[model samples]
Target: MAKNTYKQDEILEEPFDIRHLLRASSYIKKYQKRMIIAILLSSLGGAFGYIAPMITQHALDVAIPDKNFRLLFSLVIALLALYTGSIIFVTIRSKIMVEVSQNIIYDIRKDLFEHLQKLPFQYYDDRPHGKILIRVVNYVNSVSDMLSNGLINIVLESFNLLFIVIFMFLVDVQLALVVLCGVPILTVFMIWIKNKQRKAWQAVSNKNSNLNAYLQENIVGARITQIFAREDENAQIFQDLSQDCRRTWNTAVRYSNLVWPGIDAISVCVRAAIFLFGLVIFGEGNKSLGTIVAISSYASFFWQPIMNLGNIFNNFINNIAYLERIFETMDEPVTVSDKENAKEMPTIRGEVTFDHVAFSYDETKKILKDVSFTVKPGESVALVGPTGAGKSTIVNLISRFYNVDSGRVLIDGQDISEVTIHSLRSQMGIMMQDSFIFSGTIGDNIRYGKLTASEDEIRKASRIVCADDFISRMPEGYDTEVRERGSMLSQGQKQLISFARTLLSDPSILILDEATSSIDVQTEKALQTGLNAMLQGRTSFIIAHRLSTIRGCDRIMYIDDGGIMETGSHEELMAKKGYYYKLYTAQLEEVHKTA
Candidate 1:
């Protein structure tokens, strides 16, 4: 193992600033008596370390002065006892340190995960998954190491330094004072190096996170990149990020190299001066050979604590910055939150209405302009429009995915804002244009719809949505593992599973945002059969591109410039010969020619 040296310049911010550390340690300290035992043991170990050289000096000096073999044997036994006791104390302290650090890491990970669960959908929209992942990984584990071995070492080193100083002064105050003078210079060197490396390490960590983010986004959007023929451009961009990270890491290494050489020079010069001075005292017939050896040993002791302090401070500072980020995330005020007296809803009848709603994501660009609509209980509505026509915004509004900017969205005539989000969300299901599937056993994926759902329920829901046909054809049926994003399954099969998931929930309102846009005609026809049954008595919003999907909807509305331009039954919209007529006519004729 590498020896740790104190870098005076590396003294980081106070360890107490991190509230989580204080809070975490508070629990450990609750077992204050136990920690005191560890502290006592560590102090015992440090004390014994200083006494070893003194005992040796005594054995050499007195064994001859008294011409007594019996006295020499007793001194040898005393030294052995000190070694044995030190070992026992250190072992106990190590165990306690490990236990405390593990518990702290446990609390950090759990609290972070819980906080993430409570965040709204838009919170995830702006953040990258990889950046979030680094917190649970790179940051937490590093902090754990610092808490365990690093903290214990620091405490022990301090005790050792104090013991060495006192022992040195007792034997030779003049030499000890000379050695102490160099400490301030070492401290200055440390501060300069620490600041330089601190900035560099932070840069590397940030760039590493960015690189991971780029990889994650590109991998997930690979299909789009390949279709657009932009793979080479993205690859080059990722390369640039990787190189930037490398540059930062190299810069930190370059500055850190200066510390050891600078410290080494100080150590050599001081040791040389002490050696020459001690030899002169011996020559003057006042000091014994044993005294010089003990003083040299004391000198070795001083550097370890000083050097160790420097190293601990450097890493501690860098690691604290990471903890600061975690605390910041924990402290962020949630824009939407569950009410103090929130009630859980068990059953729902869907009647969705928007009363004079106006909304915008950014303050300057209004997306929904005075939009008003109503769907009676069990009525299905289709929102049709050109791109960026705010078709998807209507579905988002009903689900309360984003709170209305200036209007009220009512579910079953109860304002959604007044109802608990958990209560409102339970009654709604949304299937977006792009489906998501996690890597897990097929059974686990289905159970995600309702976390507490039983195996029988999962199987029945899969069967109702016609997913059973393909699922059974697989080698393991419902037990098959779905690799990342369900890549192992066909696109149609993934869509079927997604449909099965929502079916298991049995939501009162279903929002289908171009749900069938990815599947083929044959699979679409199969899915539509089950979907029709699912939406029969439930209020639903369908954002459709294919005319067939919206044909049976209760009302079909053509939206343009953030308002409903026309709305009626599908047939009624076709009869109007307006925007909807042109869209349906163009799509219908294209399908007819292909047939």
Candidate 2:
């Protein structure tokens, strides 16, 4: 089996940032009325919870001693009212928060998607799709519980704790002080447990992202694994990844386990202390059985809020890591956004130039250096070279897919950076070597180029690329469904559809990057006739490895090592016996050997 090449997950070690939490909460501001109402209802419900114990103490102390059946019945009825009100308040609060949480989540997801659309190509090139997917979908969900219930619980429970403490003091100061002492101990324990669990949850999140990335990569390359009969080997690799995720998840679960038990133990110890202390007071006649019972009730009530608050706080800490991940994506600066004063470009005449342009995907390794070139309006130019010879880079620069690191790329005497990207790209059509065909009908995909394109124009474009022939032969003709990535179609058919889509856009500057590489000889011949007609009165750049495909171009340029090695018409370069001549002859010899 090949060694596992995936890198280990990078566990984030930074301390939790409160700013991310604050920013996440800011989304709720727009739902202010709903949140306020929820908080009010929840608080009122919690206040009603204290009434039952008061009634219990009253019945045992005052009504029983007096033997007042009427007073006992009245107390029972009041207790029922309190319980009923509490339930109603809780129900109403839950309904409001549910809608509030959903709306906030919807807004966040929408903003993230809109931001992704504006990010430059290089941003996507550097990150895995699954990692980004988790931030936008899964991570957002991780924070939902905390956002929906955390704030409401904190508000209602804090009020309950305050009221419980005050009520206990009213009943008996001695027992109240004892209960308060246990709080500091619980606070110290909470801090220690919370910190440990935060780190553990972060580790779990990292492993989850790693597992997602691995799964996505394997699924996309499932065909390659099957072709090589390496299914067992790949399964073993996946098992290792799954085991790593499981181990991290267990670690997080262990930390969570420690939290509630520790709080429960503190509650038990406080109760024991309260009971023992109450006996001494009862012997001294300073507190009656009813007063002691009421004090104990308040002590239990006190721990209820403390336990609840601890759980809410723990959830918030756990969710901080996910919030940070989400905000990190939002914080990424758009490297290629349009200038504030950028103007919408007028319909271009399609003259393109690169003036001493240099570019590097990274600072350490340059892809193109000090390269200069020009393509006049309506000229058809073919760039031919071996792989890694910068032919594709030149075309990319012309289309502004990647901005030049140094120097300028100009179209019709205007720097590309000076114009709005939308207006500029709308007039330029780029069909990459591996075109992406979205899931839709054949006619729908064609109309994707120009959404308002008429059916007549769609058919005309398809006929111009020779795609209409096979398209018409399909069972549903143009209405046939092209499944995900056009997976159901042959390579040649997908490329032809891509061409038809590009042609329908009516671009002033057309870029075909190895566009015809997939078609067979007969299809290529038919495509060439249509391509020749399409090339007239529009500037076009073709990047090709096949020498025969570009023979009719107005000029052929041989590129190597980030520079133009030779430039001339095909016949001129053949006569010169230069780099182009050798490269073309080598391909011709290879063709004859295959024949």
For candidate 1, the 10 contiguous residues with the lowest summed lDDT are 1-10
Predicted structure with the largest TM-score when compared to the true one: 2
Cα RMSDs, all models: 5.3, 3.0
Model 2 clash pairs are none
lDDT of 2 by residue, 46-122 (tens): 77887677788889889999999999999999989999999999999898888887887888889889988887788
The regions of model 2 sitting more than 4 angstroms off are 1-6, 64-67, 144-148, 280-289
Candidate 2 TM-score versus the reference: 0.94
Give the Å shift of residue 488 in candidate 2: 1.9
Worst 10 residues of 2 by lDDT: 1-10
lDDT of each: 0.78, 0.84
